[model samples]
Target: MITGGSSGIGLSVAHDVARRGASVTLVARNVSRLEKAQQEVELTMSKLSMDGKVQFFSSDISGSVKNISEMVKNAEASLGPVYMLINCAGFARAQKFEDLSPDLMKQMLDINFTGPMVLTQEVVRGMKVQQEGGVVVFVSSQAGLLGLYGFSAYSASKAAIVRAAEALHMELKPHNISVTVCYPPDTDTPGFVEENQTKPIETKLISEAAGLFKPEEVAKKLVDDSLCGAWSSTVGLEGFMLTTLCAGMGPITDAASFMAQVFLSGLFRSVSAFYLWSFTRIVEREHKKRLENKKSE
Candidate 1:
């Protein structure tokens, strides 16, 4: 089951898993997009000559608990118990701390953090009972690792997912359940385009340092890492550095990740200091420009 599976990285993940002959259910709020995504998955399955089912569920993950529970029940009824639950149904709204409204903050927490938590709770109950266990993937962002300008609320929400997934990883390890948190860099998605429109100058410049990635690339990496039960799924050199630097007592799923984090912490710390300095300089320059414009006005 892939939430936010209507489009973007989520849809691409649906395609990736479908290629592996996994029965998939695309979950999102848009019925039309879900229909289209379902058709796409079906096409993928057809090409591979796989017999697994492709389904879609139109429901808001951030809505009432009862509704979300029912949606899970219906989904599982259609496609059997969810073996993998990818919590990808989230959005980003770039706004400065001062510009963030109360409603906007609440909405970010609701959709990005609480929604995934609630859905995972519902699905995890059944996953515990299944003998084969399961896998859970949470799609967080690089912003979650390091808070940046114009992402005050968005970073908080995504960070919450990271911490929550850590706690969950400990709890579910005994049950043979694996929890993976995917920290994707800026991917070329519809959501990314929308988010860029409202980004502050500092945010835009600081984020551009990471470079953009294709959704298919991100999705493939996410799927591969989750299937391998890797604790943190990311892409590129910078992603590796961030994940290693920010991995604070997270589940040590592999010896290689542990070794890298142990040996590279100091080096990454030095590198991150430089990045932080650059980001601060950008923010300072932008603030100076704004003050100059205000004085002229």
Candidate 2:
């Protein structure tokens, strides 16, 4: 089962997984997008399986109890056993500390952390009872590990995922269930590009400084890493360092902590600048190539 499987990294992961003879059950919010994604998956999986059956279930993740439960049941019925769960349905919202609101924070948490956690519980029940046990993957971000200029809510939500994944991994170990948490650097998704156009000046500058990742490449590596069930899989250098620094956020505070925050923030800004510049250029080139292709067609 793959949540957020309608677009971006989730779709890519779904496409890859269905090829390895895994019957993919895709979950997302938009019915049309899910249909399109399922088609793409079916088209790709055809080369690998002559009888692969893929299913799609659409639901918004903002706490839909009955609908979500039904979707899972239907999906399990359509496919076979639910042995693996890849949680990729998530997004980052850019907001300064000043603009942050309680509602917005909850919104971020509900989708990025709470939804995945709930879905994991549901799947774990099935896997546990069936005695087949399973693996769980959460598509977290480097934002969770490191603080960015204007990602307070986003980072907090993602950070929660890391902690949640770790705890869940430990608990599920007794049931032979492996939980894999992933952190990918800035990737060349339409979401990233759209964000760059309107994010804070500081965020834009910081993001520009940090290097960017390709969605396809990141997607491939992320799914592979998840299947391998490593403790943690960070896709880039910046993400790795941030993960290390975030380890001691609770213990560090006061004047010394303030200084450390300043230093770390500066370091983050510096590193992100290079990433932003390189990735923005890549997107620009790709955008132009796409325009040319459309004109020719």
Candidate 3:
């Protein structure tokens, strides 16, 4: 079962899963979108093979844990117990600290991290009961590994998943259920575009320097990693750069990781300064304009 399976990485995973000859159960909001996605997945699967089925439950899995349980039960009844679970249902939003509220932060956590973890719990319980163990993948982000400015909420949510997956991977090993947390760089998806909207100028400047990924490339690596029963994976070369960046360079390699960190942070600081300086200039100009208007009056 794939959550947020209607689009982006989730949708891409759906196609990959079906092509691998697994019947898919897609969970997401928007009935029409799911239906459309289901059709596309099936069509692609058919081109790849003669036998594959696609199904979907069109409701918000982010609403509650109970809904997730019920939906999984319904899906099991139709698909004969899911053999895999991909926690890909997440969204991104960004804004300055002054503009975002507590509720919005919670919503970010609930959907991006909480929703996936809670929903996974429901699915894994079934796998445990049946003892028919399978694979589970958490689609985390590089942002989860390193703190990026303007991503306090998003980063926290992702960091939680990375830690959770590492812990769970150890716990679930005895059950023969493989757990993998995958981190990918910015992919060319609507979600990425949406996130760019609220991206702080600092983050945006860094993002502009990033190498954009096509969703298919990310999906391919993910499917391969899941099949290989990996405990953790970084989905691309860009991801590897992030891994190195996070690992921190040492004296043997003479790697200036501290410098790297500073370099990255400087990019953001510069943009932040730009915005602040611009705002200051605008206000000063406005004040001058007002004083001149008063003199004219």
Quick one: best TM-score, which candidate?
Answer: 1
Question: What does candidate 2's lDDT look like per residue over 47-109, in tens digits?
Answer: 765466788887876577666777777778777668888888887768678887888888889
Give the Cα lDDT of each candidate: 0.93, 0.76, 0.77
Quote each prediction's TM-score.
0.98, 0.80, 0.81
Q: Write model 1 residue lDDT over 124-241, tens digit each, in one string.
A: 9989875569999999999899788899899999999999999999999999899999999999999999998998878889989989999999999999999999999999899999
Worst 10 residues of 3 by lDDT: 248-257
Worst 10 residues of 2 by lDDT: 248-257
- For candidate 1, which ten residues in a row score worst on lDDT? 125-134
Of 1 and 3, the candidate ranking higher by lDDT: 1
RMSD to native for every prediction?
Answer: 0.9, 9.6, 6.8
Residue 129's lDDT within candidate 1 is 77
Per-residue C-alpha lDDT of model 3 across residues 84-125, encoded as one tens digit per residue:
888888877767667879998998899888788888888888
Identify the leading candidate in terms of lDDT: 1
Q: How well does candidate 2 match the true structure in TM-score terms? A: 0.80
